[model samples]
Target: MKSSKLSIKFRITFWYTLVFSLILALVFFYIYFLSKSYSVHDLQEELKDESADILENLYDKSSRNDILYNADWTKFYDDNVSISLYDKNSSFINGVLPEHFPDKVPFINNKVRQIKSDKNIWLVYDYCYEESPEDSIWVRSIASYGHWSRILYNMLWIFAVLFPITVFISAFVGYHILKKALQPIYTISDMAKEISFSVNLSKRIETSNTHDEFSYLADAFNSMIAKLEKSFEKEKQFTSDAAHELRTPISVIQSHCEYCLDELKLTDSVREEIEIIYKKTTYIGQLISQLLTISRTDKHSFKPQKEEVDLTLLIESVIEELQQKAAYKNISLLFEYIPQNESYIIQGDTMLLMRMIYNLIENAINYGINGGCVWINLIKNQENTDIIIKDNGIGIEKEHLDKIWNRFYRVDKSRSAGEGFGLGLSMVRFIVDIHGGSIAVKSKPGYGTTFTVSL
Candidate 1:
């Protein structure tokens, strides 16, 4: 199975949302990093100030050792800050240690270090005081980061909730905007598709009032279609004129040859040559007639005279006319009307319908083997009437089936030596199309060919 493809609007919306979400994620990360950095920096500054004040007070007191021993370490403990002091031996001297504090503090030469535990994060500032050579002491001021962590946690929740919502909203808005932007293109495409050589090419694409790219594109497409319409008109005129001009001369040649053969005394050899000339002239006349019909049909100038046509009777008449030709090859031509009493009635032109049936039967007879059979079945259902022409003849190749309906396209070029100019099927297709009917052919190379025309 083939994979389904995404439409342009969907693709554009997806890319827009993806890029926007990526940019938002980067911005959120930057903000988080900046917030954390600023919080840590502010806490470091406060810890430094507190440490300096404690050190200055210790130096001013005359009995510093007595004051140190008598200091209330619990007073320094608060919701946002914790302080701890240690002596030269790395033993805790005073101040409170928060729960779950590490037994060892890795000193960083007076710089602050961050320590994390299961409960809280701490920023420790290790300061050294040289009161005397033998009495050097270390003061460690630690501050809790629980307040900053809570702020960051709340921000994380906000981002998690808003990211998908933002993406969905952006995708929705982008889809509509892209669809509206491409609306004119869709209109232009639809109009172009409706314009064809057989259709009215005079119709132009509708343009927008705004002078945008879509408007410009519409104008350009209209101009191109106008040129195409003029080209087709010229081509149709040439075909009609050529066919008309050649018809009179071919008829004259055929008539003069017949008159000469009848009225003048001619040798047998000369008479045979004249007969060939007459036959060729007749063929040329038929070819010109077909060309003229096709030209008119292509120009949409051949308007059918609509009437209730008995399709069964039409097929029978065509078969009767072509029966002698089929008999020459010993081919049997049979017709079967499904409902004997009910007329296979349809609204169409009598002449064109007859022509269509004649072409199909003639083709089958010409291509069929000697003593083969051609069957014509007229079937009527609730919706439409079906004319099925099946021939047990030399079947057409699969590759040539599609091109058989094309004008002047022969499935087997060798068939050109016969009475066909390759216009019969093309004409049949055109007649079916103008009548708002459908025709389909099924064939296999060694078996047979079947043409089903539904009207």
Candidate 2:
């Protein structure tokens, strides 16, 4: 298949890739946040511990009068940590006071304690200790809240670099993998497209590789194509044979008519010749009519004007109708309707179905031996309606049994050429197919032939 025709494959891959990327983004986001939170908390705790020791040393220095008292005390603080000191008078002593601190010293001022500045996300720890009986010092450390902001800042670069890179790589690999996987399907589709109505059916899908669903599909499609090719070939042959058969009688009639017209004397012999021409014309008309019926049957238009037909009555009527033909042929047509069940009310086109039976009977009478018996048994079982026509005539060969149902195919070429149009069994098969029934013929040369029809 062409890549354009496999748009469904791309659609599925797009959705899958989209979902996978979403999940990847979510996972990376979760890891970023977790790492930022943990790193920020640990860093803050470590800074606090180091800053507390520095404040202790500063207080000792102040007590010993080792430096100027009015110097900028905030200068002693590290840049990574903030510091604030309050005197015992509850006044600002060193570093900058929180801009929005409450006027009154809160309960947290008594000992080393942590507090949050609402105006900004700052962590503040306050420490207070008695320097002397009337003097005390207070220290507070402050820093920015750690995890969330750091993660946001870092992920900007990561996303900017990763998304396009991942998409390019994924698209390249997905295309090649999908193409390899669908190669067998492409082969089968190409073969199917090449199939034409007039094809000889020598080409079939290649199945030399592995076995899978595509192999099964190829086998099934090839089987159907084979059946259709065979059927079409049979149709072509039937038409050719039918035309050839009808031409002979038409030529005879034309010749006879021309001869009668050329006669100078309008005598008894001329009248006899005209009668022969008339009979030949009538026979040609009947052949044409039968051929039309067979054509309609092939087109599935042999719709019987249906009625609730009784099996026993229908068979008796058909036998009575064909009794004269059988008598003239010196053949015995016996019908035995064994009603295995009382409910034998079948729904079908009675007239067409009767014609189906009539064709079979006439065929037997024309082909069977003098004084030969044709046994027709109708059995209405629990499941189906069975009609069997068995004749003990010159039975067909094993090879011809399969071809006998095909149009214009004859077992005895010489005999079939003389009598009917060679479409009786073909019409029978066509009618049975339209009625959703099956027909099987069994024959043994020099023994007999039996046609079993089940509906």
Instruction: Please report the candidate that would top TM-score against the real structure.
Output: 1
lDDT of 1 by residue, 156-196 (tens): 99999999998898889889989998988788877877775
Worst 10 residues of 2 by lDDT: 62-71
lDDT of each: 0.84, 0.69
Give the clashing pairs for model 2.
1-186, 304-349
Clashes of 2: 2
lDDT of 2 by residue, 1-455 (tens): 54666476677677767777788788877877787767667656855774566466666765423322454656435655656666776676656544554345452542333345554445556666666768766666655553345556768688768977886677667767877877877888778776542133557877855567878887888898788868865885685568567867777776767666676456888677787777677667677767756555544223556668676677778889989978986889988875553755677777777878888877777777778889999887667898899887777777777787776677683226226767788778866766678888887765667888887
Query: What's the distance in Å from true for residue 154, model 1?
Result: 4.7
Give each model a TM-score: 0.90, 0.44
TM-score, predicted candidate 1 vs. hidden true structure: 0.90
